[model samples]
Target: MAEITDDQINTALARGEAVRLAEPRAASVRYDRQLDRVIVDLTNGCTFAFPPRLAQGLEMATADELAQVQMLGTGSGLHWKALDVDLSVPGLLAGLLGTASQMARRAGRITSSAKAAAARANGTKGGRPRRSA
Candidate 1:
């Protein structure tokens, strides 16, 4: 693997900060224990919050572990050190709970009892008919 130098790291950091400044970014992040939500205060004077459980890598995190939320690299992202997770602020705000595959699985979940019942009912009707060859 190619080694990273200190200059490269600094340059990258600078670029990240520039990008953050070019767009609305988080000014602060907090975990509302009472509401069980992650709240972010943006520089644009707007607040955004979401349930931690709705996010991947944070579904099973304890209150204390999640309360350690911090703004990463000039507020371009959020970092949960204890959980070893990092999420982009823009991505989260844009409704990306995790990686594409993870989001796909989440979207495909059939956890609702009603959905299960419907599936069973469909199965009784022979489920989906195979396409003609």
Candidate 2:
């Protein structure tokens, strides 16, 4: 592995500061049994919550395991040691609860009249345009 340098450390610190200014940082995190959700209290006095099932590794987590939530990396992430799970707070805020493939699959399973009509319209336009070699 390469050795760390002063310039690299400074640059990383600067980037972290920029992100801290723009993004919400979690002040505290907990799993609410009654609500069946993981709640995050932000430094800005904002509260965010999401069901465990929506997250990738947390889907099958029990209340005991979910209750072991801990903040990580200056509150930009969450960690569950027992579960061996780590989740990005920013990603969670952005609705990224799972992997790309999982999210795509979930999206593909959604059904609505608008979606149906759009699919029909696309079908009329030769289904989908073929990729060029």
Candidate 3:
């Protein structure tokens, strides 16, 4: 039996292929910028950190919208109506990095316009509501 080299493993990963692992029983996930990695805090109390650039690339949100992203579930996926960005965590984890940033940028414009309208309706000039007397 021969040991697999890192280049081979990375090549398989780059092709959107799956790689078998030892089946981690306990793994918690979170982003860590200081370490520039996605830290998977495990149930065994051990932490595994992955590169942030890779995770960010795989994310379905823009740089700004990514800041506003809210994780909807513990499993996978994120939703940001304000940014109009929705993405599956699994795809990201697998390094898919689909098209969500553009959508979010476009949606951000719409959201801003809507907010402006609401502000206008509320009287942006700060005038008191006129009495119908």
Candidate 4:
């Protein structure tokens, strides 16, 4: 491992501050039981909400568990201590609910006109080709 340097630490901190300033950060957060959603109140006075079921680790969480959310590191993230789950606030805001494979699994169950059209197009090409192996 490389040795740490004061200059490097300062540079990294500066970059983090720049990112925090440029993005909407959580001022407060809560789990709305009635709505079954996690709501985040941003420092910019904007509010955002999403269903807990759509988030990977949160899908099976009880209302009590979902209510255990805490803001992490300058409000750039959210953590559920009991569930051992951590999610990036910016990533969530950008429509990312989980890892690639997790998102793909969820997406596979969704039906859309565009997806149907694409499937038909693929079928016209004899569907997916078989591997040589």
- Give lDDT tens digits, candidate 4, residues 1-133: 9998999999999998898899988999999999999999998999999999999899999999999999997899999999999989889999999999999999889999999999999899999789897
**Residue-level lDDT tens digits of model 1 in 1-133:** 9999999999999997788677778999999999999999999899999999889999999999999999997788999988899999989889998999898988887489898998899899999779998
lDDT for residue 62 in candidate 1, whole number 0-100 = 96
Relative to the true structure, how large is the alpha-carbon lDDT of every model? 0.91, 0.94, 0.51, 0.94
Candidate 3 structure lDDT? 0.51
- Alpha carbon lDDT at 111, candidate 1: 82
Model 4, stretches more than 4 Å misplaced?
A: 1-6, 112-133
Show the colliding residue pairs in model 4.
none
Q: Model 1 TM-score?
A: 0.77
* Ten-residue stretch with the least lDDT total in model 3: 17-26
> Which of the two candidates, 1 or 4, achieves a greater TM-score against the reference?
4
TM-score of each: 0.77, 0.74, 0.30, 0.78
Best-fitting candidate, scored by TM-score: 4
lDDT of 2 by residue, 25-127 (tens): 8999999999999999998899999999889899899999999999997899999999999999989999999889988887888899999999999999989
Error of 4 at 20 (Å): 1.6
Q: Per-residue CA lDDT of candidate 3, range 45-65, in tens? A: 554554433443434434444
Candidate 1 at residue 53, lDDT? 89
